[model samples]
Structures are given as structure tokens and as C-alpha cells.
Target chain A: MKRHLLAVSTAALLAACASAPVVEHSKMTGAEIAQIDAVLKRDFRAKGQAKMTRLEPDAVQRECNLHADNPPDSVARSLQEAQLKTIKYPSDSLLGDWKNGRKIAESGRGMQWNEKPANPGGGGCYNCHQLSPQQTSHGTLGPSLKGFGKTRGYGPDMQRYAYGKIYNAKAYSACSHMPRFGHSGSLSEQQIKDLVAYLLDPKSPVNQ
Target chain B: MLVSGRSVLLTAALTLAAGSAAAQSQFEKYQKMVAEGSPVELFELVGEGLWKKPQGPKNASLEQCDLGLGAGVLQGAYARLPRYFRDVDRVMDLETRMLHCMMTLQGRSLEEATKRLFGNADKPSEMEYLSAYVAGQSRGHAMAPGQSHPREQAAYELGRKLYFYRTGLWDFSCASCHGEEGKRIRMSELPVLYKPEAARPLIATWPAYRVSNSTFKTMQWRINNCFRQMRTPEPVFGSEVVNAMNMFLTVTAQGEPYRGPGTKR
Candidate 1:
């Protein structure tokens, strides 16, 4: 088992820690950043959907860079506040099909330079969070979100929560690691509403 | 727990190869530039400051915030997580534990806490920075997340069962990519969760700093993202399933040195 092997390595790593010549990659300096950026600009070419702008950081990214991601408290609050304004709550009070939502969440084929512009994109949720009772093929960058409706309750409040969270995680957490799905139009309002239904509908597999 | 597997490493290698090969030379150059200075350092600094700052509802700092290592102590606690919490009566990881602290000490509502499970601004929820800071403390310390409690043990077992349970259009499980090794996709390496050796190095590294985003990533976010990729529904925050997966991962990591809040490509 992997756990057993890890135990052995831990012991060995510790045993050799004392006199093991430490070898770690050296960090890049500011000059390196500029030099690399130059090479990147020269080598990068624009493509469909995935454009040259993909490399460009928006305002928040620029601030994160200027402040090294730990923006001043006031700055962080303001940035987050600014981000919160970007969320658009649906007026239709809709919940699209969960069955369809499931398909959207599972698909990871989109956004690549080669992806056709006409191709509908995938949400790639499983790459970061656990979602189903049966699925094993998943990632852990984000938290497991099983039993979403059971835990959060299938109320309008919960519905809004799902919509907002998926719409723009940063609006809630200014520096959230989650991509701004709807805010950036990576997903559509209709799609986000379906995801909400997927998480909050009692009959949805998430609750079932 | 349903998400555990060795595919991460394989995926990483494949992603690495594909990304390296498919990515234009400029993209690689940009990645190299981005990798510079390891933006995690900033979050680490923020976390260090938050560690001792006293500002909770109890008018207390997280200085006494016990991350399962007795009160006010945080040395080498990273790799020993996903343990039982008497308060919640469940196993919690670093982010969940911090949520409890923020609630009990800082008087935050569950809504206020989970409101930003992903991460946010000035209120930069303690999850990411705190997790990064905590993991950083135990950097190089061997992980020994002892699942001595009955619940901890149960969570691990349940997580294992979930890991192998498969259903979907693809009939895929966590084992699909992770069960195998040396498989890759784009420009990343998949650490084999089934292999403790693979899981150990990473279990504690989360709440990691991402160069692309220049921000800290929490375990919850990581878990949530996986579900997104699986095309499954998102897991609720602080749910049993999330904690079980945490326990499973932590259990497998039972002796790998914790080195996190570390830089990730």
C-alpha cells in the first residue's frame, strides 16, 4: 500500500536528513520574471477563444502581483468588495435540469487553443472537487461537495448560494482559488442555474 | 474519500509533457516567470501575521487555536491532520478546523464562514492563509496523521469504499486515472493517492500557493474542483463526505513529511 511505502520513505528521509546534502531548486529573481515574460510574449500566438489575452492578468491579478498576493487589508477588502459587485442574480428564479448539469460538470473538454469556438465547453468540476456518491474519478483542489442540498437545505437561500458561488467564488472570497465561471462567462446563467438545481434540488442525485 | 487515487501524479506527468510540448515557448517562458518568487511567500507572510494577531470575538488571537496539537501550539502539525474533533464530533482538516476557530473565537456565522469557502479579500477567510501558514510550520516534519479515534478509522474505511465506487456516463471512478501510473494529460503530474508515497508529499502541501493565481488554495477548494472535473455535482462544505475524503487522504499520508503552502505550478 502507498501508506506503508510512505512510512518507509519518511524514516529514510529523516535518517538521511542530518547529512543529506540539501538540494532544492533556486528561486527566480525579478530579472528572471521579465526575461521569461519576454520570451513568453515572443513565443505565444493568439488562437480562437483562447486568445493572447489569456496571458494577461486583469486588475485583481495585477494587484495580487504588485502586492505579492497578500494585498493590504484595506486593499483586499476593497478588491473583494469590487469583485462582489460583479455577481448577477437571476430574476427568472430558474433551475435548469440536474441531469444536464451533471453532464456539464463532468466534461473537461474546452478552452484549449484547439477547441473549436462552436464547441460547448465543460465545467471540469470533478478535476477539483468531489461531487457524487458513486464517482471516484475526481480531484481535491477544492472541497468535496456531496450531499449539497441535504447539508445546505434546498431553500431559495441555498439556491442562491450555489448560483452565487458558481457565478463568482471570488465575490465571496476575494482571493478565491475558484475560477469566475459565470462572471468570466466560462459558464452561462442557464448553466449556473442548473448547477444550483444540481446542488439544491431534493430530488437531485446530490441530495438523493 | 471517493476522490482518492494515484491519477494526480500520472495526470501531472501527462499534463507536464503535453503542456510542455503543446504550450508555446512563450507560455513556458511566462510560466517560468510566474514561478519566480513563488507568490506563496506573500500568503505565508500574511498567515504569519494572522497567526499571532488577536482579533476574535473572544478578543483572542488564534494563538491558542488548537489544530489538534493542544492549545497555542503549531509546530509540526501539518502532516498530522484529518483527525477527530470532539466539538463537531467529526474529523476536520486544516480549513474546517479554522472555520471552527473563526466561529468560536471570531463569532462568524456558518454562512459567513462557508460564504467564502473558496477564498476572498480583506476578509481573506482564514482557510487559505491559515492553512498555508500551518502547513508551512510543519514543512519537512514527517506526517503522522493518527486516526486513533473510532470515527477517524470509520471515515478512512468509508473513504476507501467511496474511492472505488464507480458510476457515471464513463463509468469512471477515482481509480480511472489514479489507479494507474505514468499516465498523463497536459502539463501536470498526478500523485498516486493509493500509493502513500505519492499522497504523503502532497497531503499537507495544500492550502498551497498557486503561481498562476498568486494566491493560496485551500483543501476544500481542491476537493471542490475535483468534483467539478469528475462532472459530478459539487460537495457541500463541511459535509461528511468532504471530511471522509480528508481523513482518507490524511490517513494514507501517515508519515510523509509535510511541506506545504509550498509553491505549485
Candidate 2:
């Protein structure tokens, strides 16, 4: 009688599973997000330059996480406007030397746990976008910036746009994959200006 | 007129062929060549020795340790791992199970067992060696990770959540790289782990020897390193979070043959 009952219960359990409703994948629940945060907090420990605070998501990050990096257009515009206000452009100029800019873009160092805090961080531009045709090896995550200045007019307005974009990419596209180099304090104002020149300067190899 | 038309068609075909050839990256070709002649066998041999050697306080070998299968059964054991053991009352991955054996049977402390989970290129860690040996034993056996049990199901669900849960400084998750199909970073191809087709091949060949790093890396090392790159804090060794992620991946790749301790670029 016990064996028969066990068999009947197992069959019922199987039936329940077979007819179970599939969960929607459109968005994660608040409770689910909280659980994930709790798990991360429990598992991860601070090491080197990477602190526990890094786990906390900013407003933009939280929105991106909720929407899978595809937030509604109205929401994105407001968030982007707020982000744009954060950029602090220099009064003097928006362009720097293209020669130094090439070096900054080439290097993929700094901000890692092993890296020294004193050392200036690299822009790591080559890791996502192609700049100069001479550099054969480059990542293809972002659109190629080869012949950028020559194609898109090398004017003061263009330079300002480039500077702003490099400073905080979220200002233009709220959920863009590009890192906010200047906003995150990974790249300095001078460093961002240099990257703008690298993209917009007539003399740069990228323009060549 | 017919001869002229045929020549025109041939010329167009040649041009298309040349265009496609130029599109293929040279780095990808080199990576394929390196993978073909990888020295994973050497690591497997080293791992076998470490598994048999007894050097803890109690001086006990791991041969008596049960890996989901019965005691001393190396064959087909790895394929059915990340399972719920009644004794532990939790779902444990292969690495966690080994850590348990080392502490219980070998009489080693938690700190001593986990002190050097990740080793340098100069010398591989004990966990790496054991993982390579154990994973190798399951070669040709089907991947059948524990999913039927209640605890195992819970672990898998947690892992699934973690895969998509984007946080940290970079706002990256495992899904940032592995979620998309046919996407790549530079020359390296990223596998979509949630999907069965992509997950199967990748899960089968892990606990691999990375050619780029010149070191044997287990799944634990892989998870830890990924977190490092994601700009997150270091995960605790043998942590529940790490094991859950493993369970999720292994269960996603269920039914494919275990053919790993593989070579990677």
C-alpha cells in the first residue's frame, strides 16, 4: 500500500511540473534583484583597489539592469539630460595633442585590482573602437573611428561633441556599452580632450 | 556570347571569395592552431599523481571520497556532479566536494585547503590538478549534473538569477559576455551559456589549460577571474554563489559528453 502511494505521489509531482507556467523574462522582480544583491554581498570580499562599494549600482546602472540596457526613450532622455549636467568641460579648450592621445588609447591598463592607484589610467580606446588604420589589432565592440575627423567635419562644435561623449557616454546614449571614462574618474579632463583630438585632429593618423 | 557570360560569372565568384577571406581575422587562425596542439595531457598526468598522494595531517588520499557516485569511483562521477549529498544536505560542485574531502578525510583546516586555490604559471595549485584528473576520467561519459533533487533545483535557479543580475562598477554580468550568440571580444568567441547548444561544448571542456595564461584553471578560478575583470570584489573560495553558478551551467549543458580538461586560448 505504501509503495502504491509513493508511485501515485511521484506521478502527481511530475504532472504539476509538466503543467507549470513559464516565467516571463521581460524584467527581474524587486525581490529577485534584492536576493542577487544579498548573494553578491555574501560571496564577494574587498580586494586591492576593488572595494565593496563597487557592488552598489548608481541610478543609471539600476535602470539599465531593470530594462536589460533598453530603457524607454522618454526615461532615457531624462536620465541622459541629468548625466549631461554632470560633465565639467574646461574653459580653455576641448582639444589636446593627438600624439599623446594615441598612446592613451593604445594602453589597456589602470583601474584593475593589481594596478597602482598613483599611475595615470589609460583611455583603453583600442579595446572597443578602431582609431588608426596602422594599428592592425583592435576590438570591434564599438563603431570604428578610422578617418573620423575627415568624414565628420573637424570643427570646434565637433571637438566639443567628442569631448562630451568621451567624458560621459551615457549623456548621449543612456544604456551604451561604452565606459564613462571622465565621469567615472578613470580618465582626466586633459585625457578626454586628448581623445577628442585623436578623433577630430587633421594631423592624427586616424584622420589620415 | 556564351563564353563571355561564363567568364563574367567566374570573375564575380573570385571577387566574393577574396572579400570573405580578408574578413576573417588572422588572430582567430592562430588561436585555432594553438588549440589543436595544446599540452593538456601533461596537466592531466600531474593531476592523477596529486589525487593519489596523501599529505594532509591525517595523511589520507581522496580515493575514498564520494563524488556523487559511490566511493572510489572516478569513472562517470564527474558527469553527475553539483549534486545534493544527503550527508552535506546541500548541492556541492566538484571543487567544493574536494574541499570537503580534504577537510574531513585528510584532516585539513578550511584555510589550509583554500589558501592557494589559484596558482601561478610557475606552479599549478592542488585543486587545478585534482580537477583536471577528475574531469578527464569522465571523458566520453554524458553530462548529467544533478537537477532532479530539490536542493539542486534551487541552486540552479540561484545561478540563473546570478547570470543575468547586472551590478558592480562596470555594470557587467556573466550575460554581458556569454548571453549573446555569435558575439566576440577581439579574436575570442563568447559562448551563450543559457542556450543548450553553446553551453554543452563549453561546459564539457572546462577545468582547462589556458594557453594565454600558461596555467591550469578550474571553474572556480574561471569565475573568480571573470569577477576580477568585471571590476567586482573577489568571491570567497568554494562559496555557495560560485557553486550555484556552476550548477546552472552544468545543468544547462546536460546530456553532452564530458571531454575536457581542455586547451583554451
Candidate 3:
């Protein structure tokens, strides 16, 4: 394992050396980091609600960028463990308003630079996967989650998975197209519950 | 004293390093390729041949169908869809409207055609190819959805109301990301729909060929996705609400050119 890591780092180092200006530090130097920030600030205009801060990568993000999306196995496992620890399940049962779930899944609005600060957001799940039978429009970024509850069984374990997955997909698959709903504060607790009900409720069109 | 402190700090750092190495990589590659000329061109051919070819009960072709462009006119029709039809009156997006056309013109069962919309090129599942073909026809036309009819006007008004209507777990409305220009999440540009110029082109480009998924996606499919993002109740199939939303967006994009079997990231 150590040898493989060494090989990867070596390859990265070699690639870096061959590419352009030499990078001397394992970590970005203060000047280098500052320069990148300055460049972005100059180039990207801040619009309505969209701000320059969106470009800033947190520590975890920085780590992820350092490695390729498929970082070493140890790295994936560790990050997942850390992510899993952050999830907070509801004390009550997982069911909510499926009608609301329909609305949430169908909605593609939220968090725009021009969006009113008080208005909530949409999950934009349909942008990636198939969820309900009725709605024909949807994106293909993620897997079609139709028959989610029927196939998985809308039992306790699954309820947890749906809720948790909606909350933070990184906990399950370190690199899932499904958003980090809770982590990013994109969806609230009740909204997550409603999404769960949408997928798990037998009466919901998704299962039907 | 400085050297002693440095050694202790180094030891602590090494010890802690053993614990935090489990992070995954953030791929920048996916972001760079957005809107890099869609690969739907290949699917366009497959769809075109299927358009006039007949296999259903009526032994007819989709050539005489009206996709919101009067009858038998294929030019720039794909983009101004999901509007109100006088005979049908009710609003319908591309897939549902096509289902009506195939049922009436091609004599296929609604079940067969409806099921075909989401899947591959198997029997009774030609919507994918058909959509690709139809979408290909208006590849570069502007979004010129006409709202001359009263029903069309009504649908547009309803859709406008729906676009801003916030009712769901998250209280999300369509205007959240798309209402604003210059907003992108994780490298995906969220086009502003309030601006007709921006919304029209995108609306016109659906029934696009998604290369990564290798499937044809209708505008209804795109709206369904927006619903997913909104965390709201999934709309019913061929429901008026869906039509209403389409009319809303279509009218907003009234004068933009048409383009379809559009390539999406």
C-alpha cells in the first residue's frame, strides 16, 4: 500500500515537474494560494446571490482536489467514515408528505445568486435520475431511483438509507452525483423526510 | 527551545497524519466538459429514419403530425412544444404530445408509446429514437413558441404562477437557481429562466441526446428533474400542471430559436 502511494505521488510529482512552473511545496505556499484567489476574484464577477466565496474550497474539498476523484482506497474509506459521522437521523419515523416530495423532486430552483435569501431550495434530483413515472422530464447525472422503496423494501434500514443518502450522499459513496443535501444545507430535515416518503411511500407514484 | 518545540510539533503532526488520509479526490475533469458541443448528433440519424418508418397498427408515419407547428410541418416545431393544442386544448409537453400523435396518426397504444419514451430501441419503445429524430429537425431554430390562443395564454399564465409557486418540503420554487443569471453549482450553469432569451434556447434544445447515459431525454424529463431538485411532490404523467409549466417556460422563450436532440452534460 505504501509503495503504491509512493508510486502515485511520484507520478504526480513527475507530472507536475514536466508540466510547467515547478511546485516546490507539498502544500500550496501562501503566495501561490493567494495568487489563485486573486485571479479568481479578478476574473469572475459576483452576481446577485452568487458570491466569490463559492470558489473557496474548505479543507475537505482541498484534500479531495489533491487526489483524483478515485483517491487511494484508504483515503476513500476514511473520508466516508468522517462523512458518515456527520449524519443526524430524525428521531421520528421516516415518512412525510409525498405530495411535497413530488414538488421537491420536480423543482429545480434554489440557491441562485438572484434567489431571495428567505426562499428555500430544490433538490434537482430529476436532473440526474428517474424517480417518478408521471414526470417525463429529468436529468441523467445519477441512477434512476424509480422503484427505490419497492425494490429495497420501505423498512427501517431503507428509510435510514434514503434519508441519510439525501442528507449526505458522500457518506454512502464518497463520490456520488447525488448532492450533499444536508451538508450543503440545500434541504432541511423535514424536506429530507418528505423526499424519503416520496421514494418509500407505497402510494407515492415513484413506487407505483 | 525553538528546536525542541519544532520536534514535538513534528512528532504530533506525523502521529495525526496516520489518522486523516481517507479523503477522496475532487474531479475537475467533469466541470471542464460542460456544453462542449453535444454528442447528440449521432442519435439524430437514428431518430430521423424512425420518423417516417411505420411499424405500428395504422401503418402511418409521424410525418403528418403537428408538434405545435400546425400539421405536417417539421420545421422549427420541436422547440415550441408543451403548449396548448386547440383540438386537445390541454397543454402537453413533447412526449405526451407525441404519444397523442402516434396514437392518432401511427395507431400505437398509449401504453406502448409511453413506455417507449424512457427506454431503448426495443419494440414498442421507439420514443427515444423518435424523439431524437424530431428534436434533430429543429437543431438550430430559435424558441418561437406562439401564444396566440386563449388556452395558450392561460397555460402560460399558469406556468408562470407555477414557476414561482413555492410549495414543498424545502419551500423551493423554480426561480431559485434559474431565475438569476451567472449562478452555477459545482460547475453546472443554472440558466436564468426569467430572462426569455436565456430560457428559450434551453427549452428548445430538449429531447436531447445525453451521451453519458446513452438515452434520449424529453423536456418533460428535464422538468421532472427540476422537481426532484425542488424536493416537491412528483407531478403526474401528462398532467395539466406539467403542460402549464411548459407553456409558462415556452412562452417565456417565445422568440428564441429552436435546437434539439441538444447535447447535455
Measured by TM-score, the strongest candidate is 2
Worst 10 residues of 1 chain B by lDDT: B164-173
- Per-residue alpha-carbon lDDT of candidate 2 for residues B39-124, written as tens digits (9 for 90 to 100): 77888898888888897999988889999888889987898888999998998989999999999989999999999888878988
Q: Name the candidate, 1 or 3, with the larger lDDT value.
A: 1
Residues B1-265, candidate 1: write the lDDT tens digits.
3755433443443443222335445445544444454667777778888877877456667777788888777887666677888877878877778778878876767876676666653445566777767778877676666467898887776566445433222223455456545443232446667666667667756767665454677877776666544434345676666777777777676655666665565
Clashing pairs in 2: none
After best superposition, candidate 3 residue B35: deviation in angstroms?
6.3
Q: What is the DockQ for all candidates, taken in turn?
A: 0.02, 0.31, 0.02
TM-scores of the candidates in the order shown:
0.52, 0.86, 0.49
| Span of ten consecutive residues with least summed lDDT in model 3 chain B | B18-27
Q: For model 3, how does the per-residue alpha-carbon lDDT over B1-265 read when each residue is reduced to its tens digit? A: 3332223323332332211112101122221232344446656676777777875898998888888778878765675565667777676766778788889998888777666355642322466677777766765554545466777777665566455433333334565456556544433557767565576566666667564464667666677667644444345456666777776766666544454556654
Off by over 4 Å in 2: A1-25, B1-36
User: What is the docking quality class of candidate 3?
Assistant: incorrect
User: Worst 10-residue stretch by lDDT in candidate 2 chain A?
Assistant: A15-24
CA RMSD (A), model 2 = 8.5
Best by lDDT: 2
Alpha-carbon RMSD of each model: 21.9, 8.5, 23.4
